[model samples]
Target: MAEGICCEFLKGLQKIKIAEELISLGKIACDIIIISLISQFKSIISMLFLGHLGDIELAGGSLSAGVANITGYSIVKGLAMGMEPICSQAYGAQELTVFRKIYKKTLRLVLVACFLISLLWLNIEPVFLLLGQNQAIISVAKVYITYSIPELIAQAYLNPLRIFMRTQNITKPLTISVTCAMIFHFPISYILAVYFNLGVRGVALASACNTVITILGSLTHLYLSRTAVRPWDRQAIDMRLEDWKPLLSLMVPSVFSVCLEWWWYEIMILLCGQLSDPQASVSAMGILMQTTALLYVFPFSLNQGLSTLVGQALGAEQPARAQRTAIMGIGVATVCGLLCFAFTIVVKNVWGKLYTGELEVLALTSAALPIVGICELGNSPQTASCGILTGSARPRIGACINFVSFYLVGLPVAVFMAFRLDMGFLGFWYGLAAAQASCACMMICIVVWTDWNHQAERARGLTQTTEEQASLLS
Candidate 1:
């Protein structure tokens, strides 16, 4: 009878533990979404400002932003993600020194990368011309790209800093920092773009200023916050070429994985530019993309939070816990996706008016948004699986799957539907929906078949190496 009572107590304790974990995940996911939404709104504000200027500014801004995102921002962000597993696992192992070293090195690498990307941006005009973009919009795009330089530089620092804090489960500071920056974003953008009549350049500058504010705010918070981890060491900030091997191993695959997905979206925008009534098509897509960005924040937050959770779980030698976290992330993502679908459908016909009063653009956006909403259905689970891959330190698998799905399967369907079938801009979205569904299906299978214990062991090895390396360096 006493043994039976003890078992009952144990079961109750287990239930409480599960409840606690669910609550913790919910809190982290909420914090991350709040911060992400604020950050995304900065860009949306820019788009809104530019869209109000005219279709030329809207098309040009969207095109330029798409190019910048695909060629520069996505790459930098992907490389920074290489630090996710490292920092999360190191924090889990309580190896602050290793975490600091990886963070510092990643910052340096991305700075150099940003420099190279800026060079490309500097001479982006000729490249756009070569791509056969509308010449009128191309010239406008040049001005927008030029002003975006400072933001690019700021992002190089901001991405790593954000990841560093995220790994340590310190999210409220990021939320506060981004919120402060977001508060400044709209007023600053309004002054420069509308009040001063600076046009797209003003919008770009406002975005840069907002990013700078976010970076500074985050840094200040990190310095003041007394987390379990100690302050970052000044001595640990140097770049070590030997360390590049491990980071690059992850970074290269990560770059391809993220870039492949982002680049496909950009390519879709470019394809829209090639359609009849190019300006209207591009503007409609720009508005739709902005709307989609809002829905994306939740799933992306899950990706970040779950990646850290799974990484930490694996680092702590809890394979089952890591697997459970991945499953929970997918479940949460699915629910978010369904909710977004309903919201998107409800707002599709009206949201375009928020960007522009152009009847054609609004009509096109209304029709296209529902399709984008359909894509979201697949996007949530696919993105969740991506987070699992990141945490498992198997980014190559994600990269390979992305290439096969987007390049091999998705792109052809988009081209065929848009051009051959003469579905025009709508065809591109249909292809996008198909691609997302296929990618999600593939990723779900992989996650289910993943060897959780092996993933945990891999995380163990990664953290263990840092210990040995620190001993040697010391």
Candidate 2:
């Protein structure tokens, strides 16, 4: 009888732990969505501002932004991707020294990359050539992006800053950070874009201003952290090429994984530019991409939160707990997918007015959005799986999965359907749906296959030489 009673108590304790985990994931999901939407809402409005200037303005802005983003991802984020996992582990291990050094090096690298990219964009002529723009459109996009430079500098450093805090399960700061930045961004964008007749350039400047504000806010918060690994820990890092092994290993895969995935979307925009009546499809797609990004934002937030949580759990040597956390996060993400799916079904056409005056583009984008929504349902799960892998510190596995799923299968199938099949943009989007569904299945399979508990045990004992982990890693 005593043994039976003890078993009942143990079961009840497990039930409570599961409930607590579910609650935490739900809160993190909501927090991520709110902050992501607020910041992205600024860009969505910028797309509208450019769209009003004429489709050329919209297309130019979208095109340049896409190019710049992909380029930045490849160089900056890719190099910095190793920071999150290492930081997550250090943060969990309570090793302030390694955490501080890694970030100091990363932030320096990020700032340098930002300066170089800003110089490249401001020069304007080469950018125009690279984008294949005629003189007039190039001049406009140059103004827009040049004004947006400070923001990119600020944005470029964001991964390291956010990832550092994320390692400790700190998520509230991003919401506050974006909120403060927008306070400066929107009003300035309004003043420059509308009040001063600065046109696209004004919108660009406002975005830069937002970045400055965000970086300042984030830095201030870091200054206040209990961890001494805050922004000022420069002395902790050796700052030599030889000392970079720990950070670089993790960052390389991270940068590739996200860049490759987002590049596929940007390429879709470039391809639309080649279509006959390029204005209709490109404008429609630009609007649809902005609209769909709002939905994607929620998933991104959940993914980031999960990545941090999983990393910490693994750091703490609790594999089963990490599994439980990942499962709960995915479940919450699915519920979000259902709501987004409903929104697409119900409000598909409502947002097009925010972008274009053309009735035809508006109608076309509405039809395409529902399709994008379908893909998003699958995207949410796949993204969470990505977080699970990252948290497991297995970015290469995620990287391999992304390469096969997106490049090998997703893009090829999408291109075939979009042009060869003559489905136009709709075919492209439908192909994405098929690809996302397949990828989600693969990710789910990977999650089950990975031995998280064993990984947690290994991750706990950071005694292995960096070369040793490299050998074991995929």
Evaluate residue 58 in candidate 2 and report its C-alpha lDDT on the 0 to 100 scale.
Answer: 79
TM-score of 2: 0.89
Worst 10 residues of 1 by lDDT: 465-474
Runs of candidate 1 exceeding 4 Å displacement: 1-11, 48-60, 133-140, 190-202, 228-231, 236-241, 274-280, 348-367, 466-474
Error of 1 at 447 (Å): 1.7
> What lDDT is obtained when candidate 1 is compared to the true structure?
0.84
lDDT per residue, candidate 1, 323-434, as tens digits? 8788878888888889888888999878988889999998898888889889999999999889988977778888998998898888999999999999998998888888
Backbone clashes in model 1, listed as residue pairs = none
The per-model lDDT (C-alpha) reads 0.84, 0.76
- RMSD, each candidate, Å? 3.6, 3.0
Shift in Å, residue 209, candidate 2: 2.0
Q: How many residue pairs clash in all the candidates, one count each?
A: 0, 4
- Looking at model 2, which ten-residue stretch has the lowest summed lDDT? 462-471
TM-score per candidate, in order? Answer: 0.88, 0.89
Evaluate model 2: give its lDDT.
Answer: 0.76
